[model samples]
Target: MPVYKAPVEDTMFVLYDVLKMESYGNLPGFSDAPRDLVEAVVSEGAKFCEEVIQPLNVVGDEIGCKRNEDGSVTTPPGFKDAYKQYCEGGWLSLAFDPAYGGQGLPVTVNAIVGEFLSSANLAWGMYPGLTQGAMAALHVHANDEIKSLYLPKMATGQWTGTMNLTEPHCGTDLGMLRTKAVPNGDGSYRISGQKIFISAGEHDMSDNIIHLVLARIEGAPQGTKGISLFVVPKFIPGADGEAGKRNPVSCGKIEEKMGIHGNATCVMNYDEATGWLVGQENKGLNAMFVMMNEARMSVGIQGLSQSEVAYQNAVAYAKDRIQGRSLSGPKSPEKQADPIIVHPDVRRTLMSIRAINEAGRALVLWTALQADVSHRSEDAAERQKAEDHMGLMTPIVKGVLTDLGFDNAVKAQQMYGGHGYISEWGMSQFVRDARITMIYEGANGIQALDLVGRKLGAHGGRAVMAFFNEVGTFCAQSKDDAALAPFVGSLSKGLKDLQAATMWFMQNALAKPDNAGAGSTPYMHLFGLVAMGFMWGRMAKAAQDKLAEGADERMTAKLATARFFFEQLMPESSVYLARVTAGADSMMALPAEAF
Candidate 1:
């Protein structure tokens, strides 16, 4: 079994030391998250996930979920018990609104807990994870009656949730979905359709499953414009808002997937299920986007989660496994050979994984804080800026982190040689699970397109310009700090590269369009490198401050790792720039008949 120790200390470093969580005390709900309290909550959450949930990871993969003759699904043993404990622990309400039976904490604090759970056991963690997204969507778009009907139970984890959008015919193109909803003449509609690849779609863990679905109404205009969002529960709520009669929703079949075997990714069949519209007529895509964006962020965490676990196991293996003599003289002369850690190549691999994981953690946490500011800030201007930043960074976080995360998992598996390829070591599972993050939640290709296509010019280029200004200001401030010169210098150059790439697209893409499409992926990755570089600079400055204050070995280690990131990892941005600048000619050269 792969061991997973909760990274509580690393999380605290980002939360308090790097981001300064204390300064946000003035915001509503943040006042309750004092350092000691946040630490205690994170510690307790970590203990629960590590002890109660993590052991089920292998079991879930092996046993998977079973479908019965009655069409109900059964999860792996202990999943239900673990979910019960999670609900009783009040975790579902941790970051929700108090008006709906929640504890009303900051989303940033909740995100830390979320990362830990995901790292410990991603498949099991997904049950509550999907519910969190559903709650977020309903909280924003659902009417009062709908909120009253669903939010309370969902907030307490008594009911779980799922998003139903994809059909056999459609994945990314929502305009092609065939799910239908016809008005029943009583302020409700009858939803009828089949949806495939619905994660957490069918399970016996909760009393009811609230599905936020997308379907077209009768005689509406074609495409996504005619689509509408609906809330259709597995069991219809009675006048008292408890699960009553059965709704017409049923699981057609559970997908036999490459990973996340514990989650019931189902093919769902809805037969005239009772449903209510969420946002507005002919605007379901808008309401559904709220849930999609939230899920994308969660998917990005899934990327980081896999990398962290893979890195931990790889570190352990490198220390224990005996290998050839060190290139430098062998320090462990008592043994026949030195440990793999002594090898420069092994060190390079470990450092590469570590550099990305640490910096990725910082980037996600910073964005989570931005989400908090977007939702909690008193100043309208501050909220708008934070919202714009969140919109701009979302695709990069989802795209880059998952792509790197899968690569990191493969590298970790490489460290184990033959054992990594085998099943018992658990490294293969991490890679398989991380694979879906890049595909779902808007495939990384689409994410790249979104970055180049929509986010750059959003609000008259305010978001990207804001990013440039922040990096420039930081580089300027650290010019005099000799200890921080490497990180600042690398990040400054990265910013310039990113700017040049953006300008290239502006100069060439509008007329050709194909030029933009060809370069989107590279440009997305370039943006991600710069974002991670900026984060590393912030972490380096924090580490430097700690060292100046006569801190311990950990601070020294942090500074060294930051230096490794600047020296080894940040240079990849240049390659991405070169690709982006190459444009579409070579990519589109071949004729369709050539294949």
Candidate 2:
């Protein structure tokens, strides 16, 4: 069986030392999340994930979700009980508003806990993850009555939520969607549509499911401009705000997916479901973007979560599996053969995964902190900058992390040799689960295009420029420190590569749009490299400071991993830069039907 231990200590280090989260105590939620309280919450969360949720991972995958004749779905065994425990423990309410029965902690805390939940059991994690995304959207876009009716129950996990956007014909192209909503005589509307690939769409765990569906109002303009969002619950609430009547929305079928079998990825059919419009009549895309962005971030963490669990299992196997003797001579003379970990190639692979996982954790936390700042900060300039950071980093995080995450899972699986391909070892599940992250939440390709085609130039390039300046400033400040020289120097070079790629896009993309399209993936990856490189530099500085105060093996290991990242992984930035500047001539040279 695969084992997953949440990196709680590393998470704390990133929170308290690297990100300096407590320093923002003046922020609304930060003051409530003192070091001790945060530690306790995360530690308890970690314990629950390890002891309760992780053991069911293989079970969930084996049984998957089942759809009944009544059009209701049941999650894998133990999931319902585990989910109940999760809600009762107040995990879902950690970062929500106190007014809505939440703990009112920093969003960062919730994100950290989310990583643990994902690593433990991704299929189970999706149950609450989608709900969190829904709450975020409703909190931001839904009217007061809607929020009052839904947010509190959703906050406490008494209700779960799902986003309904992709139809049978539309995935990324919302303009092509044909779902229609007709105005009801009173305040609500009648929604009729079919949405596919809806995670946690229908399940027995929650009292009711709140689905945020995107549909066009009757007589509305054509295409995406006419689209609007609606809140369609599985059971409509009565005046007392309790589930009273069953809505017309029902699960058509659960998708037999590549992985995450425990999650009910349903084909939902709505037969004139009673719904209320969220936000404006024709501004559905804008309103849904809130949930989509939230989901995208969570999906990015799913990538990291799978990679982390896979790495942990691979490392355990490496230490125990005996193979040929070490090249450096007999390290274990008494044994018939040395452990596979003695091999240089194996060490290299492990180091590579470790390096990225550490830096990736830092990157996630840092970005999450930006989310908190954007939401909570009182200053307009600070809020704008934070929002810019989120807009700029979202695509990179979603694209690059998932791309690398799948790659790392494959690498870790390779450590098991032939056994890796087998189901019993559990590595296959990680590989399979990690695969969806790259494809879902606006596939990695779309994420890249969003970065290049929209986000890079958004607000007259303010976000990208700010990112460059912040990285450059970090490099400049750390240049003189010999301890951080390597990381800072590598980060500086990576930043230059990213900057050059941006310039290339600006210069060439307008003349040939295909150039931007072709280069966007590499540019997103290049940006991720620099962002992670920046993380390594900051982490290295923190490690050095800790070492200066006292001796610590953990700090030593951190420095080594940061060095590995700088020496080995950071060099990939140049390759992506090369790809970014290669232009689209050759890529687009092939004509239609040439293949």
Clash pairs (backbone) in predicted model 2 = none
Give candidate 1's error at residue 180 in angstroms: 0.7
lDDT of 2 by residue, 254-288 (tens): 99899999899999999999999999999999999
Candidate 1 residue 529 C-alpha distance from true site, Å? 0.8
**What's the CA error at residue 246 for candidate 1, in Å?**
0.7
User: Candidate 1 residues 1-595, lDDT tens each?
Assistant: 8999988988899888899989989899999889999999999999998999999999998899998888899999999999999999998789999999999899998888888888888999999999999999999998998998899999999999999999999999999988999999999999999999999999989999999999999988889899999999999999988999999899988999999999999999999999999989899888888889989998899999999999999999999999899987996999999999899999999999998999999999999999999999999998999999999999999999999999999999999999999999999999999898899989999999999999999988999999999999999999889998878998988899999999999999999999999999999999999999998899889988888898789888888888888899888888988999899999999999996
Alpha carbon lDDT at 267, candidate 1: 92
lDDT of each: 0.93, 0.93
